[model samples]
Target: MKIKYLYIGALALLSACTANDEALLPAGAVELKGITASIDNGSGASTRAVPEVKDAIGRTAFANGDKIVFTKIERTENAINPFIYSNIPYEYDGKNWNRTTTDPEKIYWTDGTSFHTFIGYCLPSAITTWEPDDKGVYPAELGAGKDEIDFSSLSEGNNEMAKEDLLLYCNKSALAASDGVTTNVSLTHALSNVRVIVNIKNFAASAIATDTQTKVIDFKLLSQPTRYTWGGGSNTLSVVKYADNNKKDIKLWCPQPDGEGTAQSKTFTFYGLTTPQNETYHGINGNNQPLQFSFTVTYPDPMNPNGSPLVKTYQGAFDKTVNFNSGQCTTLNISLNHKDEQMFLGAEYSDWSFVATPDLGELRKKSTYMTNVDETAIVTSGQVDNIDDATWLYHVGKKVYDIYGNDGESAAAAYCITSSLQMLAFAKEVKNGNTFEERFVRLDADITMQSSATAEDYQWKGIGEGSNVFNGTFLGGDRYINRLNGSPLFVKLGSNACVEQLHITAVGNVTNGTLAGTNAGVIGGCKVIDDVTLSGTPAGALVGTNTGTIHASYYTGAGNLVGTNSDGDKTGTIVGCYQASDITSFTKEFLTNFIDGTDGENPTNGLNDDLNAFYSNESNSKKFRTKFNYTFTPGSYPTLKVVTE
Candidate 1:
């Protein structure tokens, strides 16, 4: 047997021609050049035939909306040659031999003795050979048959072929040859060529790009800034107007972005304005919105600059020297300023001057009176010419009449004698013998003299002979006698006499001879019977050397007398001493008895007479008496009363 094959040489052939010179080519056929095919054995491990193609499909031009179709044949015999045949019909739009729809006149067939054909379409321009079966019973098949054709490849190129579809059959065989005895041969047709077109005009540009813009607002100045004074010298910038007497709060609001408010606010202070004005405002707009604002400024008058005047006033004398003794009639001239005139009258007089005056009665008389009167004549009526010459009679009413006229009467009788003639008559008779001695003698009614004498005689006759014998018969008489026997025995009546309550004070180095005493002489209240010496004895002519009292007494000038007996008892030379009526002995035997250290005896033996004499004579005798009374008053007087409230 012999194998049959289908072949086609590369030739440009036209099935039909037109006057327009366009060649009418077969519609379902594609030209094939330098094409080779191979078939795989039943084991699929080796190819019996390999197909080669010089040009492969390009992938860039591929897209969706394309179609593809395949035509196939198979060989089913084994002989010295193989015959190829197709059992199933090629399908197009669900019909066999359907070339009339798309590829018309593209089918052909041949038997061993003859060839068969469809009038509508012939085999495609590209031809491939098919062999028979190993049994040599079936003819070799060619063209695309049902079993060999891949419709998926044909539909792809209806528009354009995808790269994936062409890749599926790149080296595949379109024909098959076979020998007898279990060998099969087949052929396949793949429409791998594809066309692509993209409709870019149908697409719209991606949403147009967009951006946002925002608005902003800013404010400019509305007024010029002013100055405000708050207090003292302090001043601050003020957008609001204020007077000197008002104070009020000021506020401002600035419009900004919907969310952003004021950037800053200012506060102003004023002294005396009640309302504020001329304020400026500022703010920021975060959302870039326009800004609008309002401001209210207030000034209050809290103080007045011209309220009250300050004033000062002065009272009393502003001058340095004040004539204070100008009597009650004197006036104080107080200096006054204009401010002082505004002061209340009651306050002004409170600082007036004071005046002083001397007693006019005292000034006129140049003397002080014991009576209360303004006139000196009232005090001078009964005043004695000389107080030494006449005694002060009792005052009558406001007068102090003296006993100066005629009556030579006593101070008591002169006031009692009222008859002027009788008073004069008595005065002449008294004038003849108006002597102090005569008057005293007449009053006593006794001639008791140491020697008797006449009124005109200067000497006491026979003072040492005759009937008045001086036989040393004196008893405290020498003192009076010696004092009266001075050269002028007569003392004028009405003359000032030395008859005051006398005191003779002597101190230090005093002696008994300095002060002598006659019979009536007494040493500190003890009558003197003999000539007493104050030498070396605790006694003085004025005061005993002991501290005590002497009442209604006189003293001669004699110093202290101090002595100590043989038994060491001390005594004053002139007077034995007593303290609160306790006799202090100067006898030796008595002193020795006192020194025997016995409890019942007086301790007079060691008494210091000289010390007692010096204290009594020279020291302050009153002080000694005061100290003695203070220390011994308790023991000395049992019934004494010390009165205190």
Candidate 2:
């Protein structure tokens, strides 16, 4: 096909034919002659038929829309020479090539005897797109170092041309014409073929039973070009720049088809691949980046029917060493198996109270007595004077007090005595002695020392001690135990404070060691019976809390594991509260708010509600369960295997 350059006025008049003479070429112009296409079957195992000039119906195989290129080979003796070409558009009716532009460089001339031979002619060119200002100069061959291609200017034309159609081929051997004569040329396919097949086994049963609902929905072959070379030269494959964020998708020939048996496979074909050079690509889109295959699977959640579908993605690396030679079909087989299990961040303890807040019962009663003025005395009768000298005593509304000292000056002894005095001053009823002991009071500060060899020698051994013990109506005192009779006993704790860990045989009120602030309760141990594994019945300290609060305290001897609290109660290194039994209630306006003690040190908003601890919807019951691994014995509750990372 040949296109006459659109020109006007004088130029048209000169080329126009009149009755007396035939149209003629301009003084320095050369005719484009005929164009041809040859397919290069020797390059690969596959062979493609040459496009016929006209099909059975007489319609041209490739005509008006096809492109023919004329290039000037800038030959050099030693260096590589890229083809410098120009566009000579084909017109449907015109049967011969012609130069329509008036530009001097756009025109080529031939020496009559042996027409100054034109270097080559290319049809179905790939260099269809060019910068407008470019003169149609395109690289003859692409080297490993060449990063980009500029096909616009051979002599500076501004208009751009894009080879919109897939590249069928570029003539392997350059074509030339002598004495204004024309010859036919053949072009070969520029791209190689590649095939990918995925086989799935046991389609009816998935390796991961939980993922049975998973089904492949989509697949993609990333980072392959759609077309190869443009201008005709050596049949070299076109090269493209690899971009990290950009990737071209290979067209899919088929999606997953219904399987007829236990195993099924689907095949996809992609064209325009480079020949097998046995090279490996690195990332999916960088130099030597291997081609990557990725697919999406839609997994239906059998456990949660109304939940959103789980879109799982699986990706694989394609063999970079496998090359796609011209017309060579490389098939890649991928077998689908169970996907690797994914891990998630997990918590160990159930109903793991994350924050500290007043227990529901405390909030319900709305009772706050720690700050009540008339309820607790603001001041004791008198300050404790010389401990060994004169005795000090005082009386409050319904309580009696006494002043005492430790027998030894050891640290433990000092802590006991000092703590005892602080507890008395907090009660605001220290007295000269245990006189008129209607309400007996003894400081058992040295209780921890009781385990020591000289424990019996420690002065002030428990409350209501000494010969001054209840004479008649005086309060009861048993060597090392406190006998408040019916009066309330206030115990204070100091460093190394120890509790006998005995079951609460009697009811009593326990509060902080000082009246300094709210929830100022001492950090120590008290007793409550619940279900425990060590004991045949519900009795061990770890069984569970039967009443009161276990807060800001850790046991050195033994304690229950996290899951041992089958009752779904809270237990950890932080403050937690359990409901009181009918036998006793936390009566001292208890502040189980040990968490609030640190103020803003902790970031948790508040403690987990005991009721909400369990995953169950039941109220007032702890049932929240963690997915973390745990061990469960026959009678014991589940115990978290690992609590911390």
Candidate 3:
């Protein structure tokens, strides 16, 4: 197959052809010559099939030299041989596609034999054998390092990008040998371009030190065809190998050894986000196509410095379907707010742009299902769709002034709290005269409150304030609330309200000496507090004036775990719970009213793997069930387990 240099007019090529015609008087034999290539000058990657063939979107000159890989397959009336001829190297010097080796397979111009089909692809890629699938589609592999073509060069007609452009050419029809005749082969782009950009924002102060050490686990594009195929009777390029989650369901016959006695032909090159913009190539095109692209990014857990690494996953359905030509480019822009753990997606699709928008949920992290604000519009309805996840409620409302749509916690909805900002808003809402009542609140991520612990009287205003109290259930969801201070986390809790599965870590100045102000410990006042754990040195004095119930909890601080109400009867229920023996043991705090105001049983030493002070095991949590009129909810794991010595 040959194509004319559409741009240069390759006047020299014309002269060369004239010279060849002067002596090509072979009878009954067509001397195939003047074989060159040209490409479509539409919006896309350039073509470099023929030297000076600058029609490549008007941006290429084939300066790298005109080297084409041609393939010729015999054609019969019936079955087409899947593998007849392949990867025949041909060099074009402004005139003809001269075969690198003379006397290669030749098709005679006899009428009895069907003519052979001729096809050619530009140089710069590894040539593979002509192997067609059952559907007669020929697979194309751009291979590694061939992810994108750099079209930044603009030196009049010398585009460095032409070296990486992939152009395929197929003759219009099979021809029988006769007198010297010229055949034109038009080359077009065989791959589409995809550009991706991610912008990171609002990371934590310490995130830089920690996040840089993070590692990627696995990267995958769900349902993406691994193999691109073309020529299933037609010259249309398409995708194959729709795969499973691991992309291993449909295997291809890629026989390259992986050095481990296995084939290293599973998927295409996987790029990392080390840079700003990344471009990928594709062959699949359609409307309403389903795509799921995900990469595992490990970042430091903002709350737990030594805990587990946090991971983020990006998932699918950019649109119902997307229509694109072979040379089109698709761009995807992703913005991630690390502080809020939010992901926002945007897209642009056009002849000079891309059509990819990560839609479905409002700027929420789909990895942990952290943000689900249910209400009126999922995104716009002030009636309900919240910040996406337990979003930043701190900015949502002000101190005791913003109700945040809290018409009074109806049992129908539960607001999500993923950050300290949102938690602050909830606390203010309670003080704003909105008792949670039958409603609920969920903690999606571990929250670390920031405050000036150096202030002489630095105190956390705490959750419930003034005459307002948290009356609804606070579900901690096995997460932690860090940096508790001198004041109790909850200033007050209503009789029926509950706080459970919660961890309170006091890293600094929870209490300097005498437990702060009026009847305040780690928790100022509470009714039902269960499965809660308090840890860290200088831990806040816990549960001051607890006249309610304290069940199966652990307090490992050096201060008082529970204090008796100085005003009311020194009475409260502490069952299946434990406190640090190094401090004033909690068991002796009440001691059923110590006869000597000091005499008490030996401090109970509850031991466990984590805290070594507890109420988490079946024995500690369930043994007191019959004694305190409490019972486990069957199969639920005990939040804190204790073993006494």
Candidate 4:
């Protein structure tokens, strides 16, 4: 019999010799096969075919012209197992398994009749005491039957055919044609022909084994014209020019199986835009896993198409997590756009936070004269033409009217014209048929009286005869009779008559007669225009005897008199006699010093003599004497003076 090896070494050697530039074989170039083999020792051997093996020896080394046969004449003892089984299948033709030997004794070879082995010694004759090698029996048969073999049908010295062919044929007879189908014979198939296989010889006795796996990937793409859009019923894919032709767009979707052997019902929804899209997947499981999608959008230039133009661009990324159990979803948003057609109302007045002025028309309508007037009936009225003139007249009228009806001559004169000439100059009409004489006469004159001058000097006629000298005789000397006791005078002075020198002297021992009584005084206390002088005992310059009252009288450069000395009883220069009456005297310091010695128990003879000489030397001694007496009242009476000097 001819002996042949499967040439597993050739597969490894071919892969090592090939360059990296070679192309990978197509998917159909790779195939999977099933195989069963047996091992036998002289004493006993076990044999079984490999389970789940496809094409059982049909595509392997024991097929067609290639065959593997071995025999051991003797059995050996004390050997160890040398073969290892793996759950994942080996890719033999691809050189995926390492072939370098750690021990030369573990490697074996044969040249038909002669065998080289690693684990046991072979005897030339059969012996019943034979033992198996480490991998079981000698020569280690690998199949249970002749047809249970796989092949690697590859062409000799053709490196491309080794990568592209799953089965190798030695001759045309080894390839058989059945009907129109062709079959190749080889020892082993190309590595690409083998399907991924897994074997589980023994499961964990204490625990059940299970597997779980997850994978996350990020996808990115630019715009593409041939992209397809799914979902939303029959909407076509949106196609637009993006960037230049240098970048091509790509899109992706995933299909999920409802269960094993069931058609995938829902295709994963995805989108590819005219712009670039980026997506990121996170987390182990789909639940609560974040998925981020990003895109860049470029708006066309409204002003230009082919040339350089203004463009509004947006680029951003967003992320959201999905809850599988609750079906809760979240999305992030970012956008930029122009919106110009919005309107808004300002805050209402009631809702405003600050104070403002009310409308002027509203305030004006509520204002009136009655509401703005004072208790005195005074109003703002309007601006006047002459404020200063109006104020002057207002103050003048106020001063003239005392609350009572008492007359105020000085304050009244400030408001109106006084003299007849002034009245005639301005007064248009007079009331009550009153003449200017009555209305505008000298209301009153302030006059000083003297005692030395005779009645003719004052244009007054004396009354009575002889010592009383009768120019025109009258009962009182110089004063009006109203100032004295109630006695009517025989002679009356003229209304406008002036009075000057008037004096009175004592007759003899006139005790009961009163001078200047309430109705018969020589000088009236109420109204007197002339001075009066008196001498000797019981003489008074003002009145012979004051029985009523006299007030507000002054004398200066005067001529007037009343009363006379009667047995040296009493005398006064200002008043001839004051009986139980009050008098006030005023004197300047200079005048008081000049008349210093006039007051004494007995007046100084030099002072009196000097005064007499001064009086007698004057041409109007009577007027001068009384005037000096009135202006400087003698120190005999109590006085109050408000004088600067």
Worst 10 residues of 1 by lDDT: 264-273
TM-score, every prediction: 0.14, 0.30, 0.31, 0.13
The digit string of per-residue lDDT tens for model 1 on 1-645 reads: 000111212332212211222344333322111111121111132111111211222222212222112222322222213332222222223211121233233221122212211111011222232222453221211112322211122123331111211211211122211111111122111211111111111111111111001111121111211222111111111112222222212111111122111111111111000111211211111222111111121112224324432222222211222111100111222111122232111101111111111111111111112222222232213343322222212234543343332121332322222221212222322333322221111010101121122333223221111111111111121122121111111111121111111122222222222122111111221111112334333333433222122221222112222112111342222222222212222344433332222335443321123223424675434322111111112212111111110
- Given candidate 4, what's the lDDT at residue 224? 23
Cα lDDT of model 2 by residue, 374-471, tens digit: 33332232323322211123223444322232322232332122232233232332232322222223233221111112222222222222222221
**Models sorted by TM-score, best on top:** 3, 2, 1, 4
Clashes of each: 93, 59, 28, 92
Rank all candidate structures by their lDDT, best first, as comma-separated numbers: 3, 2, 4, 1
Please give the distance, in angstroms, between residue 452's alpha carbon in candidate 3 and its true position after superposition.
55
Model 4, 18-45: lDDT tens digits are: 1232344332221111112211111121
Candidate 3 wrong stretches, greater than 4 Å:
1-32, 38-89, 92-97, 104-119, 133-136, 140-166, 170-186, 201-220, 232-289, 296-319, 322-325, 350-645
Backbone clashes in candidate 1 total 93
Q: What is the C-alpha RMSD of each candidate to the true structure, in Å?
A: 76.7, 38.9, 29.1, 66.9
Off by over 4 Å in 4: 1-443, 446-458, 462-518, 521-539, 545-645
lDDT of 3 by residue, 120-193 (tens): 66643243344668776666443323343223332444433333345666653555423334445566555544
Cα shift from native, residue 423, model 2 (Å): 99
